[model samples]
Target: MSVDTAAIRRIAKLARIHVEEEALPGLAAEFNGILQWIEQLQQVDTSGVEPMAGGGATALRWRADEVTDGAQAERVLANAPEREGEYFSVPKVVE
Candidate 1:
């Protein structure tokens, strides 16, 4: 597929990008090459292939879901600019 200067200009206008007249031909050719590559990709056959989350063969490692105390409240609040008791104090936004 071929893309002309006019089409390139229209695309540039739609994308809100400014393209100079001298650079329109190069942009058009680049767009045409990208479209050609997409067209080529359409010819590949993958009827029986299963879609994969990643390219690797190993399954995702997972840990047991259990609730546990974080045990670092005072240490975490130590860096707070304003704190009350064991919590960071922030300006109230609502009544």
Candidate 2:
């Protein structure tokens, strides 16, 4: 895959990148090299490979789901500057 100066210029225009006229040739060569490397990668065979989430074979650790009361409402409200009944009181914002 050979990337010409015209193609590089078009890519720069589409990407909103400003490339100087002198740098276009260098940019084109670099792009051509990248495309050639990608083409080489496409020739590899991976027909029987299974997709993996991580490099290690370890399983994820998990805990059992259970419900419990957070029984310290009065203790928590004691630190509040303004608390009403069983809740924190704040200035109402809406009319």
Candidate 3:
């Protein structure tokens, strides 16, 4: 697929990018080159290739299951709007 200046302008407008009139041709040409490269890549032969999981045959690394955030009560409530001791003192919403 060819990328024309009009298509580039429309894409830029949709992406919230401000493309000047003179720069539209350059951007369009660049996009056309990228599309051409993608087309060329699609022409490669991968019929006999097997898709790998996680891009390899390696097993997933596991970590120890442990509590990591129970000792930071004061730090966690440091920036609270209103805090009492190590906890946040919120106003009673229901009477």
Candidate 4:
């Protein structure tokens, strides 16, 4: 796909970039070059290439799934300026 100066201006506007009128031609040429390179890449054949998960074949380690209180009540509420028993107290907003 060939890119023109008008297309470059539209792209700049969509990206919210402040590109000058003089720079549009140069930018359009650069964009067209990139598209040409991508088209060249598309011509390569990779029929049966298996995708790789990572650089190595190491298995990831996982911990047991369990739920527990994040902290003891006193420790959890220690920094509360105004707390009611085991919870932080806030001003009631509802009527």
Clashing pairs in 2: none
Worst lDDT 10-window in candidate 4: 49-58
Candidate 2 overall lDDT versus native = 0.88
Off by over 4 Å in 4: 54-63, 66-95
Model 3 regions more than 4 Å off? 52-95
Candidates' TM-scores? 0.63, 0.55, 0.58, 0.58
| Model 2 TM-score on a 0 to 1 scale | 0.55
Give the alpha carbon lDDT tens digit for every residue of 1-95 in model 2.
Answer: 69899999999999999999999999988998899999999998967875577545757878777675468888989999998988999999999
lDDT per residue, candidate 3, 1-95, as tens digits?
Answer: 99899999899999999989999999988999999999999999988887676654767999999978778887789889998776789999999
Itemize residue pairs with steric clashes in candidate 1: none
Better of 1 and 3 by TM-score: 1
Residue-wise C-alpha lDDT for candidate 4, range 19-88, written one tens digit per residue:
9999999999999999999999999886676557653565778988889776699997999889999999
Best-first order by lDDT: 1, 4, 3, 2
Cα lDDT tens digits, model 1, 3-94, are: 99999999899999999999999998899999999999999997888767775585889999988657898888889999989888999999
Off by over 4 Å in 1: 54-82, 90-95
lDDT of each: 0.90, 0.88, 0.89, 0.89
Clashes of each: 0, 0, 0, 0
Model 2, backbone clash pairs (residues 3+ apart or across chains), number:
0
Residue 66, model 1: lDDT of 86
Q: Score candidate 4 by TM-score against the native.
A: 0.58
How many clashes show up in model 4? 0
